[model samples]
Target: MSNNSNTALGILAGAAIGALAGILFAPDKGSNTRRKIAEQAAATQESLKENALDLKERVSETVAVQKENLGTRVENLVSDVSYKTEDVITTLEAKLKELKAKNKQLQKS
Candidate 1:
């Protein structure tokens, strides 16, 4: 299996074993043990929720940064192309003017 799947399975197996051990080794009465387990589960769930939210926020910030970087790159590329196009047009215009002047001189001769 993939590394990600293996890691997930390992984590799940560890959690299950830990929970079972906690229940089996508890010194308190059954009712108190059950209550403690419930409280611990609730706390763990809340912690996981907070972690997930933080991960999502980080991912969003990363994407925003990447998008802004891409936009800047695209703008720079477009500006470069525009500048090159203007240079080509100016050169062509100068060439045409020179050719026209040469043609007029040839016609006079």
Candidate 2:
């Protein structure tokens, strides 16, 4: 995008220079040449404004997508941890019951 913008700027600069040179060399009236230059400058300004808006929108969309992806990743990680914790708790409960049963048998003996 940067490269494209640079190329666009270079093209606009060249066009402005070429137009100025042509007007200077022509036999047209001084007022007419100045008017033409102003028109050209206004047109260039509008073009730059449009390009800036487009670049801004693209950046905004990219950020939104990244944010959504990050949310999804965090949710998945939480779910995985929850499942692992449940499994660990279940195993510990089973071991505890077995140990209790063994202790009761020793008391009976």
Candidate 3:
């Protein structure tokens, strides 16, 4: 299973065990004990739900930040490549023009 799933399961199991132990060891009467256990379970459920929502929000935010960073990096790389290509093209054109001029001079001689 995924790490997140395992972690959630562990949390649930621990909560269950703790709740059971508390109920088993309490000196209160049956009705009171049952009510307390119910309350604890409800509270645990709410807490778990809230924590899961928070985690989901954090993950979404992290993903968005990573995507933005990746886009910026890619744009920079493209700009650098374009600049180098233009420089190479300009150098090649200059060499070709010089060679053509020298060939013409040789033909006239």
Candidate 4:
């Protein structure tokens, strides 16, 4: 898991333990204590759901950005290769022209 996930997990765990301890230690009727525990459990469940949704959103966003970056890099590499290929072709053509000229002069002499 990521650092952010670990930190959030740790925080959630700590809050849950703290809340349980506090509610258990309170001087109240058994029914009241049980009700408080149930309420706390429900609240914690909602919090976990929200956190999971938020993390999913962040992961999706990160993946999309990375994909876009990869696409751009690929395009740049292809463009560079195309230009270099053109340059190589041009150089070869010039050399061929030079060789043909020399061959013609020698043939005439």
TM-score of each: 0.76, 0.76, 0.78, 0.91
How much is 10 displaced in model 2, in angstroms?
4.0
Better of 1 and 3 by TM-score: 3
List per-candidate RMSD values in Å: 3.9, 2.5, 3.1, 1.5
Using TM-score as the measure, which candidate wins? Answer: 4
Cα misplacement distance, residue 41 of candidate 3 (Å): 1.2
Best by lDDT: 4
Determine which window of 10 residues in candidate 2 has minimal summed lDDT. 15-24
Spell out the clash pairs found in candidate 3: none
Candidate 3: global Cα-lDDT? 0.87
Compare candidates 2 and 4 on TM-score and give the better one. Answer: 4
Candidate 1 lDDT over 1-109, as tens digits, reads 2464457556755785698678769788999888878876776677566656666787789899999999999999999999999999999999999999999999999
Clash number for every model? 0, 0, 0, 0
TM-score of 1: 0.76
Q: Taking the tens digit of each residue's C-alpha lDDT, what string does model 2 give over 4-66?
A: 878877887798789778877889898998998888788878987887888789888989999
In order, candidate lDDTs are: 0.80, 0.88, 0.87, 0.96
